[model samples]
Target: MANPAGEAARPTILRTPLGRVRGSGSAKSGTHHWWMQRVTSIALLPLTIWFIVALATSAGMTHAEAVAWIGHPFNAVLLLALIGLTFHHAAAGLQVVLEDYAKPEWVKITSVLAVKAVCTLLALAAALAVIRLAV
Candidate 1:
């Protein structure tokens, strides 16, 4: 109803003090994403070092010797972990980049999806290759 000598009153929806203060609050996923990124980065460090060392030491090995090296249980497991962590870390980083730099809404979403899909496919391929070698 219109107020006397004024425009109609606006309706008010009730909201808690916290909700008013914080707006809609966080998306609730930022912390989890941040933690995952950090964890993957930490995991990648040692795995990267091990990979470098393995590559360097294996440089002169014959093809059969290299395959045999990967067939070792410890090496196989570490290689798998390295593959997974590396791709995860890369995807996380790319996600952040796309979120920050991709302009249009569609572009950002598409970029993120593409990055995730590519990373997942690459990780799976690497894991399968390693498993094939190990077995």
Candidate 2:
């Protein structure tokens, strides 16, 4: 129907609930980012628990002992995984937030880039520390 301003009416969108959400991700990469976030978070659950328990068990231990604890193969491996996944998840989540909230396009792009870079650097540093101790 024509409006008071003599404008033509726009057609309503016809989409199922799922269809509406099918491509809601940034740059069509929503599914990948969403899945990775879930997987990393799930994986982190056990790793975090183990880390806490390990620390608790090692309470009052000497510096060398703590280093020794991290130096073990299994612990070192899990620690590395935790660091990598944590950073990945953080960068992904922060990018989504910045994309959604940042007003200027440049701000969103720069923020996402900065967040990812910082996360990468921190993860690498943590992994290196773990490797040094393990070695």
Candidate 3:
């Protein structure tokens, strides 16, 4: 059926473990997540590409040469940034996925927290390695 203004729409109900909630397209969440994902994705694009190219260029090099390549100040800084942002992005994505799909409260929370901890640790390790190499 159409409204007086001639707009027809079907309402959506959100069924969650908490309870039933109504959904609104204009609500703050969707747009916020979308923007965040896009921004991080834009960051990852150049970073991953650069890392890939760096690896490709070093493919046939000796270990010493590869170490020397990574020891450059600019390269070390970029590597650290890439590692940190990559983990942050992964944690954010997995958090959203778990929040949306996981039905059990404990499971969802544990999974999200576990992912966050592991990724954070990995990112820190990566950054430290880069810094050590640079120094």
> Which lDDT values do the candidates have, in the order given?
0.91, 0.89, 0.83
C-alpha RMSD for every candidate: 7.7, 6.3, 6.2
**For model 1, what is the alpha-carbon lDDT of residue 21?**
85
TM-score of each: 0.77, 0.75, 0.72
Better of 2 and 3 by TM-score: 2
Report the C-alpha lDDT of model 2 over 7-119, residue by residue, as the tens digit: 99998875566866785434566488889989999998998898889888778998998898889999999999989988998998999999999979998899899999999
Residue 127 of candidate 1: its Cα lDDT? 90
Spell out the clash pairs found in candidate 1. none
Candidate 2 has a TM-score of: 0.75
Q: What is the C-alpha local distance difference test score of candidate 1? A: 0.91
Instruction: State the lDDT of candidate 3 residue by residue for 1-135, as single tens digits.
Output: 898998887777555534434442444575786687788899999999999998877679887886787789888888887997788789899999999998799999999999999999989888887787789
Model 1: per-residue Cα lDDT over 1-135, one tens digit each = 888988979878666788878898656886898899999999889999989988987678888898888888899999999999999999999999999999899999999999999999999998998899988
Candidate 2 wrong stretches, greater than 4 Å: 1-28
Candidate 3: residue 87 Cα off by (Å): 0.8
The list of candidate 3 runs beyond 4 A from truth reads: 1-33
